[model samples]
Target: MSDLPPPPRLPVTFRPGHTRAILLTAGVVIFLVISGIAMLLEHLGPGSRLSFILTGALIFWALAQLARVKVVADESGVTVVNIAGKRRLAWAEIVRVNLRPGDPWVFLDLSDGTSLPALGIQPGIAKQRAIADARALRALAEAHSASSALPHEPRS
Candidate 1:
């Protein structure tokens, strides 16, 4: 067997709680189902049924998108998953992680002068918990960036 050690695993992952989103999504689905059933029983037209179903599906999709946003960090880099897209950046690419007072979410300052929002670390009723999590994320980013800046050894 080869003597090489296993690669280091990512220890930090940030994702918003799905409780509220799930409830909201479920409520939408239930409302749509009930409405559809009522319309069917009342012999409503196809247009009404289609409209109700489609609207509920759209709302549920949007809520699911909110629940899916996430930010994952490891020794190598960070990955951000947003409502519309996903991005991965190496440690050196990140300049800072900022979560200022009054801000709705955490923002990442990139080396190219672009800022990326981390929607997963949002400000809400659990203000203290969110702040604490942001601090921990910043520490992780700083540590990884510092280590990545060091000179690498040359292979013989």
Candidate 2:
């Protein structure tokens, strides 16, 4: 059987493209509609109007968090940015990348025996893309750890 191609070059980033697009798009539409309704309500007082606008802003902010989730891989390590926080993990620290069936997103099994949720690679709207990204990341981690294990020859 033919071997799979090497992982993509470093400095690569994986994100849920469709998820982000939908979230941001929906946020904008919801915000606009909410703000418009607030302004159109002639009976509402200024305080209520401002509160309505603020509510819209808050909703947009919340959605922005999910839309910003991403996984970035560079020479040093991989950075996972989720809805609430970000974490950096060296290639050697990542023992495995898993995307099992019915999983909401990729999960990274670490050398420390911890499993981290990689929300950046969700199988929503694009299952194939998520699978490809997870495999590529797994390959990169394996390749990096293997290279690091090799003993270097002494300089002449």
Candidate 3:
């Protein structure tokens, strides 16, 4: 018999759908910057050149952060990757998923008493879809948590 491992079940992913918009905006910004630099190159002093370069780098970094935030969940747990850092938590570790009204994103209430932001489910972009996705994620987390629970035992 073949020894190949079973294929992985696809993880549910949540991310902003503004990829095209973000890319287009970044591209336009870069293009404008290049044009401006070219036009001002002859007149730019050393200090002005350094300032322009630093500002350009900062803008690109911000754009990259905008495109990188995401969340992935599977049977085991959920992983949240934001601009600054990433956090992974097992289903048992997640106490609850809270996406309150007027909130920008879903927040995972953890067993450790700390909340983690799920930036991938930003509600400002598409409110309906965001709400649905958050609901589905919460259900998934609850299902896993329930399944991992111990069978009923006598209380102490």
Better structure of 2 and 3 per lDDT = 2
Question: Which pairs of residues have clashing backbones in candidate 3?
Answer: none
Top lDDT: which candidate number? Answer: 2
Ranking by lDDT: 2, 3, 1
Q: Give a tens-digit lDDT track for model 3, residues 41-147.
A: 88888778777777776777677777788889987789998879998888899988888999989999999999999898888868888888787787777677777
* Model 2 lDDT tens row, 16-116: 99999999999999899999999999999999999999999999999998899999999999999999999999998998889999999999999999999
lDDT by residue for model 1 over 7-87, one digit each (tens)?
A: 234667876665446646686777678566847765667887777777777777777776778788876788999889999
Q: How far out, in Å, is residue 98 in model 1?
A: 0.4
Those runs of model 2 whose alpha carbons end farther than 4 Å from true positions after fitting are 1-3, 154-156
lDDT, model 1: 0.76
In model 3, where do residues sit more than 4 Å from their true spots? 1-9, 27-35, 38-41, 45-51, 150-156
